[model samples]
Target: MEPLMDRVLREWRGKRVAITIGSEHSFTGILEDFDGEVLLLRNVVDVVGNRGKAMIVALEDVSWIMLLE
Candidate 1:
């Protein structure tokens, strides 16, 4: 299997992905770009419905990633 980050980088583009951070925050969005260390996400919205048009999150901060079909 590919490294998780590499797999994430390869398979996530233009797809909806769910990211879990810490213990309480999770967001779903279209994967935009990753510059090796940070991820750019678009059309993001939290589980509770707070919308984020775009977001940049540090790669190290992510706990899990789920690719959506």
Candidate 2:
């Protein structure tokens, strides 16, 4: 069977999501891509909900991700 992360990613691609990194940082954005090691997000917003540029997040630093849409 496909790995769980792969299945979730496939189903959630292009959707909005909220991701927590480490213990302090969080981001919300469109789930653009994930290549096993990193994630690409567009129209990103930071922890305080400040919308900014796209963000590239290293998978190792990700604590969890939640679908927002």
Top lDDT: which candidate number? 2
TM-score of each: 0.86, 0.92
Model number with the top TM-score? 2
Candidate 2 lDDT tens digits, 1-69: 998998898889899999999968989999999988999999999988788779999989999999998
**lDDT of all predictions:** 0.87, 0.91
State, as a TM-score between 0 and 1, how close model 2 is to the true structure: 0.92
Candidate 2, which segments miss by more than 4 Å at Cα?
A: none
Model 1 TM: 0.86
